[model samples]
Target: MPSQQDDADPVDTSVAHPARRYDYLLGGKDNFEADRESARLIAERMPTIRLVAQENRWFLHRVVRFLAERGIRQFLDIGTGIPTSPNTHQIAQDVDPTARIVYVDNDPLVLAHARALLTGDPLGDTAYLQADLREPRKILDDPQLRQVLDFSEPVGLLLIAVLHFIRDDDDPKQIVDTLVSALPEGSFVAATHVTLEYMSPEQFAAVRARAEHQSAVRSGAELTALFEHPRLQVVEPGAQSVSRWWPDEAPQPRPSIEDVACNGILARVGPRSA
Candidate 1:
């Protein structure tokens, strides 16, 4: 892994960043009062938002494990927040000790603490890149990503809980298409996006008011559009609530779509037409 100190970016603690706020919501301590306060404000509007984060994480774990089970040994996780247990590398390495992972994020704080995310099994390798998802070409061309991942082989691309941060003006679909296009056949894209489909009008309004600056909340159809590129084919279960996507086991009390408030999908890159 490259050293973050060589190109150390300044971190602004005065503002509430989405990654830090998400860390706070996940009960992690690598966040500031600004993040905690922002999380508190959002919680006031959506009481179950914390659970939503947890379920979103659960979805991530399941997808990583599923990919490993399908013989995928390389991973590129974008929008990776603060270091959390059972991270993409951890989960993938658990299945195969030789799995390699590349973690990408724009948060300077996440880069500052990236050393923690590098401690993977001896057989596997882990690396971090301080980059934004909007610049898919740069991320695809990054030296570290090329060093750790072989574009000729199938790689699991994780976009969990990050797409919402990309507004429509950025052309999120094209961004996704660009990333997927760079990967070889059989590579998979697993993503989860915040949705307003399950929320009532009043609840949606409250959430939008709190998160408008943070991200754009889309409906289910809009969220699905991000994965509808010609080169991609939807996997089983298609796009559905994060909690409902291939759960390890059905919850004793099953969570409704409203409880998760997010949609997730795992799709594969298809062969190009002759």
Candidate 2:
């Protein structure tokens, strides 16, 4: 069994956290009243909010399987929420038993559930790190992460439904660039971000007012801009609704972009530009 690393701070149930709120939206039991209240407020504004959460999670599943099928055996998954079943490691290891994964999240509650995440196929490895996404350097430099993932090989960097939590003032693009730069050539990045593009002005205003302090939802273009590094080449279809990212793999009659309100992008890291 892979031991959990990092000292997690005490969970504050009085305040709403993105991870717990996401768990609540996904109908998981790990969330507290504060998370449920926050999710309810958002759902009241966007009736499809629960569907959006479900679709985003399925997107994570598909992307991990996609990368693992392509021969990438190691992954760095940041923003690991409350342990939903068949997590990133579960999906990737299902494709390749030897897949190695490192999960990072700021939620103390997630760390409390780290033992469940740390279990993987005996042939593979999984480690949970309690950390915030805003500090990419700290994550990359962590010794446990370095021990599990080899920087020399292709690594699938997963930023699913988490980057939007990073405020613009925090320089999210720079943070992404820092992590991508650490990857060797042929590594890939898969990210999904919440968007307000599909909402009407009134709906957008309502959601924004409710989410302002917690999330920084961006437009499709803004989400794309975060992967602007010269070495990062976006895969087919550029940025599109998560529901439409790879529709054939998703359920039939895909949900409308207006209903999902999230965008996903898959990019490959190439050799650094001369």
Candidate 3:
């Protein structure tokens, strides 16, 4: 919450941004006609789009709370879409009042709504930066970010619903490796992405076709390789449907391919290698 002045441009209003479309799904008013149109079209084909969004948000909340309870103090959340109730800082700071978090997103609206994300306990610090994930180094080296996060110590790296925006040629795995390599060994990584794991070849083909016309969706193996630290171990119920990971109560597993298109997981960076 550094800049109070109208120092930056609002997020683009012309083309539909995935973040805005997601906001529409979450029923926020910050979205535009283009965003709503895209969301509506996709939802027409998939009626449960809003449910998926809610489930993903719940997954984020649960993971942040779990990590905070385990004593993590610093977090770097990339692709943090428009802020909603119980955002990352909310969950973490609730557990540890002194927790520090840095939220990064390319969407200008995300920066426009920085005030919401910066609301942290007086003891803890929260910062929102307008940056792209392709430039992870500049973000890590940012002065405000440096003020709040200590790279030499453990930090939670979150990449939820964002990696699909990056294509295979972007070397998403390398990006993760570079970021993870910079963190101390005890750090952790939490990630989620749209996948077509539970669909038939034809069914998956149809799903993929739909997503191709709209968003980026990856396969399970491709997502798993994104976190390839020899030392890191995935938490229980690893990379299953988001509903299955540490659910407060068991969710009836989705019985059909259309029921699940997103997968979520949490992995602890191995304690500093001996």
Candidate 4:
């Protein structure tokens, strides 16, 4: 696993954290009451919080497998929440035993679990880094990441469901540019973000205020701008609802069109393949 501080600050349970809140939404057991409450309130307004999360994870899995199948062996997964089953390392390594992964997250609770449970394939490697999304350079510069990955080769840069926590003031586009610029062309960028376009303006406002009161989330246009750069080429279904992004096994579409709340995409970081 990636290294940790000898005396890192203990987890702060008094306030709800984005990672723990997400874990709560995903029905994971690693969250506190505060996190659950926040998730519940969000669900009260948007009943499909759990379903949206699952859909995003499904997209992550399919994107990883798709990228791994294309011969990319290095992965940089940011905002890696609690060590959910079939993690990025597990998925990538399954396709190629030598696939290397570096998981990054700023949450102390997620870090604690990651430090205790990250396991890599015998032929490959996996490491966890505790770092904030705002500090893309820190993650892109981590020695552990450098040791396991070569920027000169193609790599997968993932920011699933984490960018929403970054407000417009944070200049998410700049952060993304910094990370993607560090990798070679042929690399891929897969991201999932929360949005409000699915709801009526009134419903959107209600939930928007709710998310802002607890956690910072963004709009669809804002998320699209995160991928703004001439070097990247969005894949076929660019930035669609997570449920509609290349669904394999063709999950039965929800009975209603109003079943999703998250937007995501899997784009490549190179000239379009002819």
Compared with the true structure, the alpha-carbon lDDT of candidate 1 equals 0.87
- Scored by TM-score, the top model is 2
How are the candidates ranked when ordered by lDDT, highest leading?
2, 1, 4, 3
Candidate closer to the true structure by TM-score (higher is better), 1 or 4: 1
Root-mean-square deviation per candidate: 1.5, 1.4, 2.5, 2.4
Candidate 2's TM-score reads 0.96
Candidate 3 backbone collisions, by pair: none
By TM-score, the better pick of 1 and 2 is 2
Q: Model 4: clashing residue pairs?
A: 2-128
Ranking by TM-score: 2, 1, 4, 3
lDDT of 1 by residue, 68-97 (tens): 999999999999999889799888999999
Tens-digit lDDT track for model 2 on 128-192? Answer: 88888899999999898999999999999999989998898999999999999999999999999
Q: lDDT per residue, candidate 3, 1-274, as tens digits?
A: 4523334666568799989889999999989999999888777656667877877787888788778988889999999989888789888998999999989888777777766556888999998877889888877777878888987778999998898888777778878877777788778899989887765676566567778765568776677778767767887777777766666543455334356567887888876566
For each candidate in turn, the TM-score is 0.95, 0.96, 0.90, 0.93
Number of backbone-clashing residue pairs for each candidate, in the order shown: 0, 0, 0, 1
Clashes of 1: 0
What's model 3's overall lDDT?
0.79
Clashes of 3: 0
